[model samples]
Target chain A: MQADQSALQCNACGGLCYFSPERSALECLSCGECYDLGQPDDYLARDEFAHRPDVAEPEDNITPAQRTHQCQNCGGEVLFTGPALSAHCPYCNGPVVLVSGDAGYRTMALIPFRVDAAFAKRLAQKWAASRVACPAGLADVVAQGDVAGLYAPFWTFDSDEVVQYWANFVKPGGKAIRISSTKGQMKIAFDDMLMPASPHVTPLIRDGILHDFDPRDLKPYRAGYLAGFAAERHHQTVAEGIAANSADKDLLIRNHIKYKIDRTGVHGIRYLTDTSGIHYRRILLPVWILHYSYGGHAYKIAVSGIDGRTFGERPFARRRLALYSAAISACVIALGMAIGAAAAF
Target chain B: MLAETSPLFAAAALFGLSTYFGLIPIHKLIQMHEARHELRQGSASRLRRAGGWVVVALWLLTVMWCAVFIGDWWASGDYQAASERAWQRIGILAKLAASAGGVR
Candidate 1:
């Protein structure tokens, strides 16, 4: 299939342009011109493929592993390799956005990067410096590493669930404890339960920035959003994403039941859930990943590109911790001796 | 002198044992809390079980130490002296408690 490709260009100088987070617009690097990305088209909005049987199946026009697009501005060829639907033109540094022929599920919407690269790096460094019981100068080591902005693919689901539960409880009686059984049903509606579809995002990273993006801020997917940033294709299928989402929903239902049964001395909980009206959309969320080494150990730090929240692995100062333990032990021993002497008297 | 000092030495030894059995698990809990992000399910569960066992062991050790001390005093026919010392300690504790209560 032939994919339509175009590079955002500056009106004044006709130079290549890229999306600038600070300006929230497509800015030309040559002329420093900022172009407003006008209102997004409703046709490109989310849920276009919702409730469709062929949502997971590849379309007849799906692109192959390797394809080249002629740059509109420089007439140079831009090569997109291995699930990359967009890239910068190597010859002219133009931002190229492929309009169609995306492999797998197409991205419906995205929460664009609000935090720039420099700000993300600062946030990571600050997080490293604030860690307790870590080696000194750790932040300096982390500061030396470059922060890469990535658009990580995720699946957001909306569903309605009916949970029917049977529970037993104990009540105090005059002469004995009384056991009673109660049955009830609960209806729950979940909106935008997000599941990461990218392998690059670890569980810790997902947890740290799980609630960082505001759903209301999600914009219709535009190829210009891929400008000046790397975006990942969704690696997991809809069925796999649905499985993960169901696990989380089950936990939520259990907690809801427990809350409903609180103060009833509840035990022996058994429940069955009926889920329906499941709707999902594929989208991209922004993340900044930084890799750094401290004392021969490599660690990764992830900062939420939406809110700048940071979470990462840190190196512990074992020698300093051992010294602290020895000091604590001596103090405990001295306290023990004093108490023993007092008791003896 | 031996009779008076023996209880103190025993008490100190019990405290030493408590420290040995107690601090290591407590430290493990602290480490778990600090490195919670990196901890896997299997290792975290093992650490929690270790902590629970330490608590149970400490309680049993306390009860056993009291039982051994009282049994030794009873077997040696030193009950009179031990009882007198217990009453004196109780009185001192009561007085300290009263003072603390007044301060509060």
Candidate 2:
């Protein structure tokens, strides 16, 4: 348990150290002194699915809260609930890291937070201001709230797929309908099909948050990288992630076959695909979530920490929309009158 | 008089409808792609931005040419000649399509 603690005790002032996103190092909270955590190791990926953890049963979606670890700095027992990888020691305010027993199942990878809290808040404010229906004060409300940086878990699957498809093609002629049948096979290799490893984050939200994230940004996971921010351990295993993403993969393969062989008007398309050479890597992606209330209704905004891309819900003013409608209508009417005058002349 | 030129009006209406329904969305897509480039440094952002701008520029150029043709027709007070010219262009297009076996 002591080995999991990534905090460095300040020699000059005995304060709990936090990972500074700005400097990419550990800094003492009391003295403002920094300590370099050294270089990150190479990320690892495994191709075998059989080597997955035994606890990866279909129903085993919860990380046990009973996993207790003692904080080295304060000697306080820190209880990890759900899939939380790191948390502050309640007694002495020291950071405690919990190593989920499934660490050996897959070599962990993580993209450390590049955008700091202040920048994330600024991004949220800018996004709020750009919203067409946003109330005037919503930007200020979002900017005032603290942005919580989280390292969300994801499973990236690599696979070699073979698809066999058959379809009937039809065309309408001047006097008769023509029908033809065709069959074909396709081979495709997919490098990464990303899937969310936590049930808390939906697939749609995950795609929005990690839209264009490059896997090259990821480094081998170390508790040092997760010192300050919250990290969620992977509760859904490799099998579960694959099951969740298989339908989309199948659709992708079918589309590839369609593009390669058939024209746009193909009908009654059917296919069966076989996937092999399947590999998966478990990774943590950084996101900053901001929550604010407008007219008593709460909304959440998530910004990608790797890049400043923001996504969220914002309240819209009905009056503004009505005004926009009126303006567009007036322009259209004026344009019509001008075009009519031209035709008449 | 409007009923006599209903076909011309229909073509203009179609153009306006397609511009609002189709071209507007494509323009919004260009804006979105450029915005993503500014924010995310994505691998495909640059390519998408360039391609989107080319498409928008081509659409705008076509619209400009149409506006110029209409201005010249109105200036000369030769609306019948302008309509005949449009039909002649469409007839040439039909002949090309028939030669290419696209029109049966």
Candidate 3:
């Protein structure tokens, strides 16, 4: 339980992950074994991700990120804040990242955050207090836990890819499975597709962070954003983040292509990967990460301002089932009576 | 339903009164059910296109009904008379209501 007080190395994965969730004993995402968040290192170490987590990662239909441009050389994603032309793709073990978009060449537009560390601290505190349900360390979770505000490393990309897609669709009766494909050549110019430099923050989550931010008011990456914070460095490479965001970009491609084709149903997509090069913009996005303590345990959730989007799980409210069932029964009865009257008439 | 009721506030009111008096308990029961989530098994996406069309139709009809009201006012007796008393009075009322953001 003392390990819950301060940061400790995980015996399983050597990750600096906090023993969070209040309800569950410390379940190492990297190791997949649940332990006392209090005594996480007693168990010997082993790989946990042999199989994917039972819960599937949510799809990008929620919110997606924005990047500045496309990479021309290796078609790997790019996110350069300063004047850098190219970078290496850690994935394919090749140097393929290239800057080849308008935002890449010119130091154009930006809108930095007006909120300072004091404000962000207050915000984080308020956020932490709201999660009084979590057991991280009810009083000390937000009070003592490292709440420094540093500009976390990020790579923002913006690009417009002319995507083409073909999908299979069946009629109402499934009489014939016809292919309704589209070859759309439209420009989807967006500003901030942020991928967190830290491994702790998954590309999936960071991409969502950027997507949630309103593009209409994005300030250029500024140093002041780092004013008073502890920041995480990038452990996951741009290649990995690209792989994460690619799922979404492909979906965008599908939708744009579908718009061109103009149809409804789709059975499966033959994901034609990497059609367009991506432009890059390294940026800092504001997030209020809160640590909470419930019953002798800790939990955290990131509150995004880009939109009021939250990512974390608190157990379902106990009374929810009863309330839901009552509501459903009442509605069903009313609907039935109305239908019966209509039938009689 | 504006297109259907713009000219007959009286009829719309009558219907509204009838529904209220006749289905009061039924409606309450429906509300109760909705609060407790008695909805049939369907995701939001499933409900969207089906419900969206109903909303679209309702909006269109309402707008059309308002257009009828304007047409009737324009063709009234005062507008066609040598002394424009009735038409002018209505025009003044329309102007005042417009200024108040009530008519428009």
Per-residue lDDT of model 3, residues B1-104, tens digit only: 33333323533443343333323233333233332232222212112212333222232233323323333433341223312333444454433323332110
| Residue-wise C-alpha lDDT for candidate 2, range A1-345, written one tens digit per residue | 354452456656867676787987777778899987656444332222332333444432343433555556554443342223445543223566553343223336788788898998899899888775346777888877556677777787777778889976554344334556789887888776677776555454465567776777777766667666765566555676777766556555655665665452455678887777776677888888776767887677888888777876667665554454344433443454355346445
Per-residue lDDT tens digits for candidate 2, residues B17-98, read 4355443435444355535544333222222333344344334334433443444354445667655554544444433323
lDDT of 3 by residue, A1-345 (tens): 123212334467754332222322333445654444322432221111111223354322221112222334333343422112223322111344333332222112222333443444455555444542233433344555332222344556555454434455433324233344433344555344444544445443443233435444544322222222222223333455566566445555554544444444543545343333455443445454544444455454444433334443232222333344344334433443343233222
CA RMSD, predictions in order: 10.7, 9.9, 20.9
Q: By lDDT, rank the candidates, best first.
A: 1, 2, 3
Using lDDT as the measure, name the better of candidate 1 and candidate 3. 1
> Which pairs in model 2 have colliding backbones?
none
Candidate 2, residue A323: how far the Cα is off, in Å: 4.6
Candidate 1 structure quality by residue, lDDT tens digits, A106-217: 5678888888989999999998898766788999999997576677778777777898998876654343446778889998887776666754455556666544555677
Q: Lowest-scoring 10 consecutive residues by lDDT in candidate 2 chain A? A: A45-54
Clashing pairs in 1: none
